[model samples]
Structure formats: structure tokens, C-alpha cells
Target: MDELIARVSAAIGVDAGVARTAIGHVLAFLRKELPDGPVAEFMNQMAGAHQAADEASAGGESAGGLLGGLLSGGLMGLATKLNALGLDMGQIQKLGHEVFGYAEGVLGKEKVREIANSVPGLSQFL
Candidate 1:
């Protein structure tokens, strides 16, 4: 995860610490946004969201449809984290772009797009 943070930082020319903090905020926000469930549950939610998008896009092209499940309900939590961290929306957006781009590089554009579309701030990258 730290390596992922570092790569994202490099990609977007942000400090590694900033990238790490931003991602930590995202994960923590996800945990808080989810119902009282295991971490695996959130992971499952993310995957299911992606698969749904893949299926929907098979017949026609779409932009953020693949991201719906991810961005469904976590925005407020993510915003709270950013507020606590003293990062404004622009910072959060920049971090999101870097992280999403790096994720895409690793998981392939489609898979990453699917994942990004599901998450809160990440959906903007779409």
C-alpha cells in the first residue's frame, strides 16, 4: 500500500506523505461509510460494483456508469476525512487522479475504471 502511495505521488508530483494520507483517508472513509461489516465486505462491495459495470458496458459504452456502486454513498465520509486533514477539495481531487491513474496502470484501464467509478472521490477521475 505504501508502494502504491509512492507511485501515485510520483505520478502526480505530490509528496509521498500526502498521497499516503489521502489514501488512508479514503480507506478510513470507506470503513465508516459501510455498515457494520467486515473489511472483506467492503472489498466484496467494490468487486460486485465493478462486475456490474463490466456487464453493463458490454453492450454499450459508458463513462461513469461503472463507478456508480463505488461512489454510491461514501462522499461525505471522504470529505470529512479531508476536512480533518486540512485538504481542500482540489487537493483531494488531485490525489484521487494520481491514485486512480496508478490503479489503472496496475489493474488495467477497464478494471481500474470500474473500481474508481465505485468509490467516492475516485469517480471524478472517470
Candidate 2:
């Protein structure tokens, strides 16, 4: 996860903390939108992954409301979340690539690819 943060930070020209927050927001969004099973399992196994997700969503909005917004707006909601974390769409795409590549290293390329493909709006970034 640290390596991923570093790589994404370098790729997007953001500080490590900003990179981490952005990555957390992206991962949290994915976790919510993806189905149960291996993807969820893998996310859980990764240290700090779930916490990152939780922290990203920790805000004034209720979790259900936030999730509802995400579901209603889809990529737009994702964009909003990423934007709140100080990342633009291009940076979000780059973050997706870096994070997916990091997932590939940790969870195997095929598994990560499968997970990426399963998410509705995620493939564009991949």
C-alpha cells in the first residue's frame, strides 16, 4: 500500500498524503460498487484498505446517503469524491492505473483484472 501511494503520488504529481486520500476514496468507491466474494475478500485482507475506505467516507453525510448518491450518480459521484480529495479526472484515471497495477502485484493480475472489469464505470480508467 505504501509503495502504491508512492507510485501514485509520483505519477499524479501529488503529495503522498493527497495520493493516499485519493487512492482511499477510489478504493472505497470500488468496494461499495463491486460485488461480494474475492474482490471484497482481497480488499479486506490488504492492510489499511478497509480503513482507508472508511476514512474516505467519514464525513457529514450519512454512509447510506453517500452510498445512495454514489449509486444515483455513478461515475459522477466518484468524480465528486475524487475531486474532493484534490484529484481531477485525469489524476483519477492515473490513480486507477497505479492502484490497479498495485492490486495486480498483491492479488495477481488476472484476479485484479476480473475485479476491475466487474465494476461498471471502472474499466474506462483501467
Candidate 3:
């Protein structure tokens, strides 16, 4: 997890904290949008993933007033959340690529491809 965060931070030119929060947001989004079985497996494979997702979920709930309610689901919502973390669209795409690339390294290409394919409008990020 630290390795992944470092990669994202260096590659996307964000600090480690922002990269981590952005990862949390993306993980939280995936947990909500993706199928349970694959997501569960993915989470299991990644160290600190559940922690990140849990933190994101908790933060989202506490912070979820009007804007959170407005951008509550799907790809656009995920984009809005990442944007809130100070990432532009290009950074977000790079983040996604780094994350997916990391996932592929750990979980293999086929599994990662399956996970990516399962979500609508997610391929653009890849």
C-alpha cells in the first residue's frame, strides 16, 4: 500500500497524503460500484485497502451533506470525489492507470481486466 501510494504521489505529482486520500476515494467508489465477489477478492489481495476504503466510507458519511448527496454514485461521482482531492482529470486518469497497473501486477492482467470491464465508463480511466 505504501509502495502504491508512493508511486501515485511521485507519478501524479501529489503529496503522499493526497495520493492516499485519492486512493481511498477510488477504492470506496469501486466497493460501491463493483460486484461483491471480485471486489472482495481484490480487497483481500491489497494490503491496507480495506482500511483505506473504510476511512473513505466514514469520511464520506460524515461529510455527506448536500454535495455528497449530489455526487453519490457512479463514475461521475467518483470523478467529483477525486477532483475534490485536488486532482485534475489528467491526474485522475494517471492515478487510475497507476492503480490499475499495480493491480495487474498483483492480481494479474486477466483479473484486473475483468474488474475494469465490470464497471461502466471506467475503461476511459484505464
Candidate 3 matches the true fold with a TM-score of 0.91
lDDT of 1 at 65: 38
**Model 3: per-residue Cα lDDT over 1-126, one tens digit each:** 899999999989999988988888888888888748666787888899989988977776545556766987888777777776778999999999998888888878887788889988787766
CA lDDT, candidate 1, residue 109: 74
Cα deviation of 55, candidate 1, in Å: 34
Best by lDDT: 3
Q: Between candidates 1 and 3, name the one with more favorable TM-score.
A: 3
Compose the digit string of candidate 2's lDDT tens values, residues 5-84: 88999999999888877777777777777747656876876788788777876741443365546553566776776766
- TM-score versus the correct structure, for each prediction: 0.52, 0.82, 0.91
- How many backbone clashes does every candidate have? 5, 0, 0
Candidate 2 C-alpha error for residue 82, in Å: 0.9
* Poorly placed runs, candidate 1 (over 4 Å): 7-15, 30-73, 119-122
Per-residue lDDT tens digits for candidate 1, residues 1-126, read 556666657755668665565565555444444424333343343433333223323321232233433443457545554445456777667766765565555556776555554555556754
**lDDT at residue 96 of model 1 (Cα atoms):** 69
Off by over 4 Å in 2: 60-73
